[model samples]
Target chain A: MKPITKLTENEKKSALRIFWGQLRKVNRNVPEQDKIKFLKRIPFFELLKKHQLDEVARVVYEREYRDGEYIFEIDQPGAALFIIQSGEISVEIPTPKGEATQLAVISKNAFFGELALLDESPRSASARAIVPTKVLALFRKDLDKLNSTNPDITANIYKSLATIIGNRLKATNELIERKIKAVA
Target chain B: MSGSERSRKTRRIVVYSMTSIFFSILIAGIVYGLQPMILPFIIGAFLAYLFKPLANSFRGPAITKYIRAGALLFFVGSITYWGTTFIKASLPNEREKLQLKVRLQYRLNERYLSLMNLADGGKGNFIYKTLGQEFDELKKRVIDYVKMSDDERKRFLILQKEISDSDHENKKYYEYYLANLKNQKVDIEKLKSLAGSAIVAIEKPAGDDIGNLANIMRALSHWIILPLAFIFILLDKGQIFHFFLRLIPNRYFELAYTVAEKVDDALGKYIRGTMLECLLVGLTLFIGLFISGVELKMAIIIGMVGGLTNAIPFVGTFIACIMGVFYSLIAENVHSFLPFINENNLMIAVLAVVVIAHLLDNAIYQPLVVGSAVNIHPLVVILSVFGGSLMFGFAGMIFAIPTIVIIKVVTETLFAGLKDYRII
Candidate 1:
């Protein structure tokens, strides 16, 4: 405090500007290698080889969303698959009673909107950023272009997509069976 | 808003404004520096973009990318060389005769138009009087030909003999006289009134001097810049794409990328398809004209024009037909290598050629290449063409479709993105 008082008027103004500038944070640049490693951890891309993962990482676009911002809404045309890079996303659907129901709270390293990669269709549910989040978006068009250029990688992504979807269907079936038994 | 939040927003706005201004200046400077070659650069870039898929499809090692590009360059360069050589050989010799034909065609068109006006509103009586005077002169000439002196008759015979003896196209001196004599068989009993409706007013060939800046730029772009630009783009290993893509900030990256990809896909197919379709149109026109007994030079010019202006809907057909008519009007007596052709039926034949060319374009070329319409409103299409022509002449009109496609894709995507991203 004493040192600041001793400083000249112009110097004090400069110091304050510097302090405010410091408060204005810039996003840190994540290396492409880190993106590839994170992509490898996703079950949806488990079938892809290291080189294929690298290609995907290179093609994916980084997007930032503020807390409570909707990434996409229900019935909106989905053209891309999104993977969480940081923070949280809430995947939600509307109930019959006209109330909003949270289907899942997706955290870092999780993925959503996987159906869009296979075909362009209206999204089944809405995905919104639960907190300030960064995401890596893999657009279907880019993926398709990449697939077209390399046939081997094309099959891998589809294989993984099918497996994950199949697993989800089985899990839902098991849940339904357990509910029926409990009701009986 | 709270003071800190408001101050932070104010700071962000200032930074953003400054950044935008700085970038804009940089871009402007770069554009200004490349202004001279800008046309060529654009031509080249589009060519490269259109052909990228083709280049990618060719199987080769990475090094062969350069080789393939070089081979393409060579192929294009050779074609240009051949084309220029052909032009150089034909133009100098044909210049006078071509000029004369054009002048005669222009005067004929002008006379017809004025006669038409006078016929329509009973206006321009002065033109009617001039026609009356010309009719008298024509009568005198016909009579003079009929009552030729022995010496004049001998001279005409000698000239006719010489023309018959030689098999040169320039033997038109005799053919003109002979065709005129042959076609003067207009039946007096069946003569109709020369009403305004009787005259078919085709659009005139809007002329400009050859030494214009646009023409020079066009030539430079075609011969030099187009190939260089195309090759550079074709050989790029994603660096060029990444350089531009890197500028997109994190917040807008996904939206920008997706928008760009869509625009690229749309523009690429549209341009390439349209160009190929035009090429086919030109080729068909050339073949049709050549078969229809038109002169080689005339056929080539009209075909080229036909193909180029096909971009502007009916304009190509109009120009091709009118030019074909002009050629037919000035043709030699023994014009057709094919026996079915003659001066009397030449105009019909020319019209038939143009019709066939267009029919081919509609039935085959449009479907096979362009795939389907972009579904722009007809009114919008017309206004865009008009706007483009107003700004940059015929080239603008040709470029209008692709420009509209880009705009449409970008606008639609950005609007959707803003809504879906909840940025608005």
Candidate 2:
């Protein structure tokens, strides 16, 4: 019994230190590897280097949303990106033809509606959980802290994104053309 | 280079240039032709964005697209109805008030000549009498001038016609034709001068004034188009997403996806959070004020305004507070118009309610609504709101904070590498 109590005390101290370390890590100016791990899982951080990824991770936050919850709506102002960690979600977009269309199904490791974050555009779609969802999110407000000090990394990241978004646009057009042709 | 590589490179270049040009032109055209309408378009876009989540939330395989669409339309229509009715009801009263004010000023000038005398550097009580005498003289002269002009025009036309008719038949016809031709020439010259004047009128800068319901209607029309535009956008999101991805270099998919995801998350949280905050705050304020003994109608109106204004951040609180105070003064108990309420008591009561409402907003409403609305710091919120007001005037004041937040996120991610360095 005496030996068991001693073992428990040591374990408790280790747990306390670990918790304190995590808290300290969150407040640090430099980005953390754990944060980058989440960022790297997102498509936007794919091209970021170790340090750049860390900066993103620093601004990123993790949140859990219940089942049937809204990630966002069509007309709300948008200011962040959402990367699903667990559960499934769906995207609904309104058509000019006065229809709300199901755009896509997003699952774990999936992200939707990044365009709104990049510009002042309204949300193009609404996302809601099909199941309980966990998400890692990054808001736009903290981006300046990094930009003021590191211009090159910021430029590169944007340049990379521009290229990727550019490609997506091209592919979308092709698909649209194909659909039109098929319909015709 | 290999033949396959060369063709692929050419294809890539064409796609890149074409999409780039198309997007630029689309954005430019929107800005140029729809500048005034942009707000409404934005509103429409926001409506669509907000409802999209609800639609999705209700969606299962069984829910039809049309049903979802109907629900979205109904909800939006009701909101629009309420907003429009509020404006419609208020507008007539406001317009009448404005007209009365103008009329009162004119009457005052006529009766109280002393006011003008005071304005002018006139000596003693003599100035009042002098001004009264002058005004009377001016009024008489104006009435005479108008009467004289009408009489002259009437006499000239009659005399000209009589002269033409009294002559021999052939001579009369010839004389009449000549007179008609002379009148035509005068008319044409006048029209030409009028056209020249119109061109100058068009060149003058548009005057700044409080944008009224007409402006709102125009804005609404722009948003009406957005639903139509959004339909196409929604239907093609998959294809559009794919196309955007394909346009970028093959290596950049991950980066694009990350940026896209981040943006989506930010906007989604912001929109939903702000709206939720508005509704909750509006209802809470109404209930709170009513319970505290304020008039039910005024309380509801003030609450709604306060809640909506809270969405704007910073100065929104002050505007809402002032509105609340104004309503307290205007709204009298229906029971007694004869024994008018004391202004001092009303002021004190209003001040107390407004203080409580604001306190609740700052402590509970903000944390409950705004804290969860966006993740930016309070300092950032203040900075963004102030900056937005400076750049966009009132609208800018509302939007600037959110825009700053987005910028901050983007900057943080892009320059995540440089976070440790101190630029200042």
Per-candidate total of colliding backbone pairs:
0, 71
Among the numbered candidates, top DockQ falls to 1
Model 2: chain B TM-score relative to the native chain B: 0.58
Query: Could you tell me the TM-score of candidate 1?
Result: 0.69
TM-score of chain A of each: 0.77, 0.72
Residue range B1-424, candidate 2, lDDT tens digits? 7798689879978998999899999999969987876665565555666666566556443465566766677676787789888757755453234223223333333233344454355543765466767765775454333221223223323333444444563233333333333422435343323333311223533443345657777666766776664444433323354456445442233345456556656777776777787787677777755654567666677777778776665444576568656554433332322233343245455566667766776787667755744477667777777777787777776566557757866776545412211111
Question: Model 2 chain A, poorest ten-residue lDDT window?
Answer: A140-149
Q: After superposition, how far is residue B96 of candidate 1 from its true place, in Å?
A: 3.0
For B73-182, candidate 1 gives per-residue lDDT tens digits of 77767876887887776663332443343334333433444544643455556655667567546644643443333333234434345444465554554444333333
Model 1 RMSD in Å is 16.2
**TM-score of predicted chain B versus true chain B for each candidate:** 0.67, 0.58
